[model samples]
Target: MFERFTEEARRVVVGAGRESAELRHGHIGTEHLLLAILAETEDPAARVLIEAGLDRAAAREAVRRLLGEGDDARALAAIGVDLDAVREAVESVFGAGALDAPSKEEPRRRGWFRSEGRAGRSPFTARGKKVLELSLRESLRLKSGHIAVGHLLLGLLREGDGLGARVIADHGLDFAAVRRAVEVTTG
Candidate 1:
């Protein structure tokens, strides 16, 4: 699953895992991934949340609540989320093969270490590649050097309307604000 991420995106996952482990006193899970996506300082995802009114304190509170911790433990516990569900959610959000199985049109390819005949700059993982593609699109649109975290955030914001975007919007963040913030930061 980790194999499907770009270097930076992989790092984001790793960082999220570490955070989740710290949160649960166990191992990684989807909650962690969601938190990681929300916490990704260098990625645009984080920026989008920020622009949308997901203040750091509020985000932390939401994460804590989602994890069934803090003073609202009973309320969170009542929601009831098992490890498997957590794992599946993580996979779904991260595109780590939890759901949305890859199709034959884009068969799963081997990574640099596994591929026997490749000798070029290793390609990004599926998630990373997607993020990069989004970044590139943003870059081309904005005409800038490489991709920035803000561009990545804009990309995620633009991704087919889904939970992530819904969550962001719930907090009052609009795509335009996110794009403006990215442009300002990049500029």
Candidate 2:
């Protein structure tokens, strides 16, 4: 299946891994894949998303908020919880990055001399893998011989339930409209 991926599509996958690492996330998720698509500035999919008002920074912040990263403090505040104060107290007692500790769910890979429990090295989450599979379906649906970045957008939009889709929705962009635009622009 991977052999059918165009170079640009492969780059998007690699970029998704990079994004997961950057966020210290345990597994590759649809949010990371969306970030990769936005990063590929030369792709027609990215151009269409940009023109539709999906800013990368805003999307990244949305991802963080959804994932309960440090941005969760704001959400906590809304409920009268002082997450910042709690984090500071916890960190002072447990040392820094205590709240950012890697989850046990992250698989440990045997390196040459040690185990690597890093984020990007982990496998994709189920939803993430489904999005890739959906991309293949989208390509075949479009009569495309190989998977392309545009097909990925179609898949993400079709999934319509992952954080990637949520971020798109948060941007006030209509999924059907974006999907049609992608097909029209990249077809």
Candidate 3:
């Protein structure tokens, strides 16, 4: 499948992996794929999204907020528990790196000779894999021999239930409108 990806499409996949690593995520989700496309300024998908008011920074923030805080945070906030304030207070007493330490989920390295856990490597999540598969389907549907950024966008939309879609919708950009823009730009 990767063999059929255009250079720009390949770059987006690579960028997604980089994004997942940067975020310390174990897997590359649909949100990371969207970030990759947005990070590539030269990509047509990025241009369309930017023109529609969904730039990289805005999208990134949305994804991070959603993933970082999650449902637990929302429930806590509703009950008047301020997680940020708690973190701040804890850090104030325990020093700057106190509250910002690595999560317990992260594997700890053991022994001098033992190699560190592959924290920097992130595999694609199920939804991410689906998106790539859907990208190929989209390329075939469009009668294109190579997968492109537009196809990737179509894949994300087709996946339908990812943070990427949520972020786009939250920003007031309709999915159909984004699909139209991608088609227009690629065509």
- Top-TM-score candidate index: 2
TM-score per model over all chains: 0.45, 0.73, 0.72
- What's the distance in Å from true for residue 127, model 3? 0.6
Which structure among the candidates has the greatest lDDT?
Answer: 2
lDDT of 1 by residue, 40-93 (tens): 655655665655567445655565544444233345557884554666678878
What lDDT does candidate 1 reach at residue 128? 35
Rank the models by TM-score, top first: 2, 3, 1
> Which has the better TM-score: candidate 2, or candidate 3?
2
State in Å the error of residue 2, model 2: 0.9
What are the runs in model 3 whose C-alpha is more than 4 Å off?
69-119
Give the CA lDDT, 0 to 100, for residue 136 in model 1.
60
Query: For every model in order, what is the number of clashing pairs?
Result: 2, 0, 0
Predicted candidate 3 versus true structure: per-residue lDDT over 1-187, tens digit per residue: 7789999998998889767655556678899999999987887777988888888899988987888644556678899998668867888898764744364454565521122244345667778888999999999988989999989988998898988878888999888988887877765
List per-candidate RMSD values in Å. 11.5, 7.3, 7.8
Q: Which ten residues in a row have the lowest lDDT in candidate 3?
A: 111-120
The CA root-mean-square deviation of candidate 1, after full C-alpha superposition on the true structure, stands at 11.5
- lDDT for each of the candidates? 0.51, 0.80, 0.80
Tell how far residue 79 is off in model 2, in angstroms. 22
